[model samples]
Target: MTDSGERNTMTRRTVIGAGIGAGIGGAAALTAAGFEPAPAFAGGSGKTVRLTVMGTTDLHGNVFNWDYFKNAEYDDSAHNDIGLAKISTLVSAVRDRIAADRHAPRPLMLDAGDTIQGTPLAYYYAKIEPITGGHTHPMAAAMNRIGYDAAALGNHEFNYGLDILRKFQRQLRFPLLGANAQDWTTGLPAFPPYVLKRVHVPGEKPITVGILGLTNPGIAIWDKANVENKLKFGGIVELARQWVPKVRAAGADLVIASVHSGMDLSSSYGDALPYPENASVLMAETVPGIDAVLVGHAHLEIPERLVTNKTSGEQVVLSEPLKWGMRLSLFDLDLQKVRGQWKVVARHSQVLNANTVDADRDVVALLQKDHDKVVQYVNSKIGTCTEAMSAATAPWEDTAALDFVNFVQADAVSKALAGTPQASLPVLAIAAPFNRDAAIPAGDVSVRDVAGLYVFDNTLLAVTMTGTQVKEYLEFSAQYFKQISGTGPFPSDQVTNAPTSTAPNGTPDYNYDIVGGLTKPLTYKIDIAKAPGARITDLAYGGTPVAADQQFVVAVNNHRQSGGGNFPHIKTAPVVYNRQVEIRQLMIDYVTTTGTVDPKTFHTTDWSLTSNGTPITVTT
Candidate 1:
């Protein structure tokens, strides 16, 4: 990433002598005062010590300028120009900055993971690209151009199964690190856990920086079947505690954790307690020698440079650049020698907006070449729709798009399971409203639109749940919508601020809405405080009282059934069918099966909220 403009002004460099003594407590104040001293040059070597670390995380395979769902070109102005070509420009700028600073150290580029699977490009490679030896992943090829020194593995890396993951790692130019990911049977790291580098900064002696990686432990539950045969993830904190000291003993001067986890400050989900951020905070506090943490997974930006270890009083920086090459995290650290030991004197962090920089010519060329290939492959029209197909939108209260997705998934699963003993049961499809960019407009839907709706490329999983469990599932999803009371008729102004039973006249609702089968008139009253599974009251299915033991076939993405979405009941249910079909491909199949789809065919008005024998005002 190269910058086009030169620095307009330069500050005078501070100098320090051997006789001057500075206390650790005063270092922060000194740094603030701009009294910090530059690292001394190596004796007679004319070398100055300066090192820059560049990081990117959650690059969900936005390798080309094509929109997977719209099947059209992405507008660069919409802040959607995320491609390897754009990232290369940023890398070039960083390299140029280091070159301009005569005393600056060599630069190190690192990725925080989630690079392999997101867009159609990735899907094309994973599903259609040959499994022959020396197969190249477009994302990995782009990362090579960016010249990453090392990276940590994220949970999404395992989505394609251990074989593909190993193949990806084998193809990458840089080493992939994950200290906690290990072989369960052998009790050894599945891959190299960390890498140590002796970076030479201008005007200073060489310093050893250790980069250790850890993936979220939740992969065991989320990618259970995909990884069950090959690997295991250990506790994050425990692994950090055991490894940080080892990295230090290996002569590391500074320890940086490349963690693919996240933090959440709000109490929303029942399973929010054991999130990546909480684990990260705890790891920084308990680990003895960690200096900084680079986070991913949650995909939110942590704009400030956080000082997590207040007790040790050490400044442990935690940061995350936004996902999809939308932003680049630029961490500027001032290193100074204290008693012959290198310590970070001052720190600053910022996210670079890709839209602000010019595209890297080489990266753009590479992507364009690949883009042409992908376009030709996807353009040969797999199928057609007779009518417009769309998901529900706000202020309308009903979504045809979501309903179509459920109907297709349920139908497929039911037919697949018919020969089995579970076929006799009523099947209910489980899905979430994953409106990625926005709702699909009602019209002739394209392959790109379908991709946008289900871009994750998840697999299909069939599970057996009781009718009672099905009701619990609906109640759990209803938490996303707030039921407005005392509001005017349908589509009124009050609908936006409608009060739920729990709100004191006016409060926001944090529940997810659920749609069920049409056999029963679905109705329920809100009951907060009860655990998610306990929230439903007066539940019935098809006019029959639901029994806890009554089995029903539930169709859902493999991620949810394997516990990825953190839903309560599905995680514990018995797996009845594990379809090898990819969600993206399934949508493609559905569209191709019914050429020129009408959106009305997908539209549904089966479920609604009621108050005092009157329907609550719903937008759409």
Candidate 2:
């Protein structure tokens, strides 16, 4: 729990604040509620049963403590330790402590979804190895090895289509729970809504804990092609409202919600809509009878926190473990038999860092075959780069790194649209630098280098947009910088292009799109002096003033075209060309077939910044 903050306890009367818990042992340490810390069994004699629940979420198919991107040991230099292998060792040590206490119940482990689709290993199995041909998913094998009890469905679960997801479900020993992912035809839960577990605590009576799984409603938007009309998802709060009472009525002593959503207190897309991506905070605040909530999808590590139920004013403990096996959320509930009923008297929640332990030998042995194959596959030489390319300057200025992707995308889509009616229109490509660590490293350009640069499962989409729409899209990307007024060609750091590091800062580099296909510069002076949308001016296309109705084909990713980032008119942009082949592969093919990548040939120099009337110097 000390990872982000100290462990917090939720009580009936009031939730105590910070200074009181960290041992200040004075009048200054008195809580806002003016209550001193007291032991659970301070009043009368009662049997105390302590059960620890551990959770992992957004693991995203990391099984080893090795960075598949770098082809090296996963270290602190990258600011990440992403793998279930290390988590396995950490879990074993914690379980050993529980085993020493004969009276303690078997500790329960849970996952909140996004178990697949991040690394080369997961991509190898899902796309290359073909687990659909009847092999156990590597993630499934690892989770089963670690002994997970249940997991929720995340929006990314539908990324590979339902059959593969169903195959994963078949391979898992534990149930895949999704209360809101329903059968549209039957209007019933397609997957098990919740799983009930009764744990025997040595001499005390068994306690039944119900786990409810809720997925993000964004599935319908993000994966509309795969899930359209087949499966419908409801909001987590609405679904929990219906199912929490049902689980309690089913003789459950406690209810724990495993929500695959972030803590967006205010629902995006307005109050009337069902928010899928983030609604964990609203769910925990509104839903009653829930003891602790395990949340994910935001990839934030909150050691421990307390939220008050808006309607009933009941305090609920909520914790989010950062994504990719970096941390584990632990909820330890102290339940005592009060009046013949097992009820929670005190609860504590904290996220444990997975870096504390070495990679589990069992996990390493289990995945060694696939690991070795992926290492060789990524290490295989694809082509060569004439000069090194780095995404280091992508945010501050349009660099060759992002230009490389834009050129490949525009060229591929232009070829794909050869026979189509939209082929005559000029094709403009929009791309972003997703990985700041991505670099060409000089000589050979391997699969890992290109894959590391793109670092997403996004495919290509060629959408028809007018010149006006193009400007709006650029304006959206322009929001990455803060509005400025002074004409002093200020420090580049003064601009608000905050990169996503340990936490989300400013506009994430992945979401910041730069435009291509113009003889004119894609960059322009932001007269921070003007309004946000109105700031973009002097827009030209091909040595001429851009007309409002001027039309062109724009290459984009499916995520953005599906309203992922709320780019202006992007979701509504008509698709002229679409392909399922990943853009990362296209980058590799572009380089492999084209011989060598030269910065002088493809690097975009078509961008500059100006403040007021004077030219400005911005860091690249």
Candidate 3:
């Protein structure tokens, strides 16, 4: 977090004046030319001042309204449109509305992190045509055009290493804030913790708005490969407690937190880390002086939530826009001048639909060339498939498509550990159903086809675990299915994606992984009739019962290896190999070099669900 180079260039906060007499008094002159002043405040003005703060989070490098994997305009079952272009239009509308109102202060725009890594556009700049050499990142260009006030750092920002992230930060017009991201060596904040902006009032003191940024602590595990010895993360609540009072003491009348954590208090890493993965609600409940929070990273669309702080007895509002720029969060605060100072009297929050507006022409035009280049890159031919494979049935059935993923991962790991000390151990790989609609059609294939199958930007790692630990992992995965007895045939929806403690709505598809063997298929049956942890039956490798002490090298993604999904034993297990190889790129390379994806070479029906020993057939 302590990058001396960045500290030299970026201003942590704009310290205008601690009191009304410093800058806004004695004269009637504006703060600067071309800056219009708000309504004048007198000794007893008794005016209600309105201020609007707009926010977007988890943008994930999207600029245009397009999906690179689908090679088409982005659309889902909800008919939601994504990317900054749509958000730009929505923001403009909000700003124009505020500008037309004479009682409103200047509208503020902000983002809650996860900006520089998601789509092919983000990937292209990070890896292929890196922005490290001063080439403008599409996200920075588009966000700069949109004019953000500040943005919190997301865990994914470190995926491509600090070099790329530093360059991306330098390209942005606003400060990229991360109060919890600290220096590993010094244990001090590496990024600016907060920024204070002045909201001018014509005759009275300007409203000092303090914006604090906080990121998830899971970065210590998820991005361990990139940040191991360089940066460490502190809990959001702890950091907020230490910083909020300082912001208030610095003369902030209103404080807003742009937090890159979810409103939910769940942790994918479970008790592996002291801090929870999603702790915005906890922070709100624990921290004082925060009027509102812009939440992110959970990817859940929350319109508005009010949590009472423990000490202050004040209500703090929180709102999160859905991921990929699907929505915009808006907060309205009404301030009234007291005896001698302006104080916030009322506040309300809601989300504006980005799908309601067309993509802003200005934002699209600014990054259209970058978007087109990514489209071309993903559409380029890679190889051919002998037969089509789909992941639609992957959640209910052991589809060949997932097997192909496991094969590539295990094969790559096997080769990397060939001459190493762990070469003697067998290799197994785990894959999740990331995108249900992903498919690889027969005939010639493109990079998009393979990339679609593995949508996450996860890198590969190999960890050593016992056969017993593998079964424990599979048992945890089997919890994705609901317990049901005597089923001749059941609808896929009746069993899969069941609600769990960590995921109250339901376990995400990405949490249920399929473990496959390299030299031999790792076979197992998930007996849904049994209770959660006791569900796995007849677990074996190469048709033989896996012994309790059998040690094997498991090929896993960095997310899982670094404690994502709360899988058992992997986080504490000994790492056998880690080259920081991206799994998606590895699959693409496999297809490009082999020229053909013949599932017959790797696919096998290795796992299924059963009801009291009878194979349960699932109808999709």
lDDT of 3 by residue, 116-188 (tens): 8877788889877899877899999988999999999988898799999999889999999999999999989
lDDT of each: 0.63, 0.75, 0.83
Candidate with the greatest TM-score versus the true structure: 3
Name every residue pair that clashes in candidate 2.
217-276
Number of the candidate with higher TM-score, 2 or 3: 3
lDDT of 2 by residue, 361-479 (tens): 67777877777777776777778888889988777666888888888888888887787798788888888878878888678888888878887767788788998888888777777
How good is model 1 by TM-score?
Answer: 0.69
TM-score of every model versus the real structure: 0.69, 0.72, 0.74
The positional error of residue 326 in candidate 3, measured at the CA in angstroms, is 0.7
Off by over 4 Å in 1: 1-50, 72-81, 130-133, 264-278, 308-312, 383-401, 408-446, 452-514, 518-540, 543-620
Give the number of the best model, judged by lDDT.
3
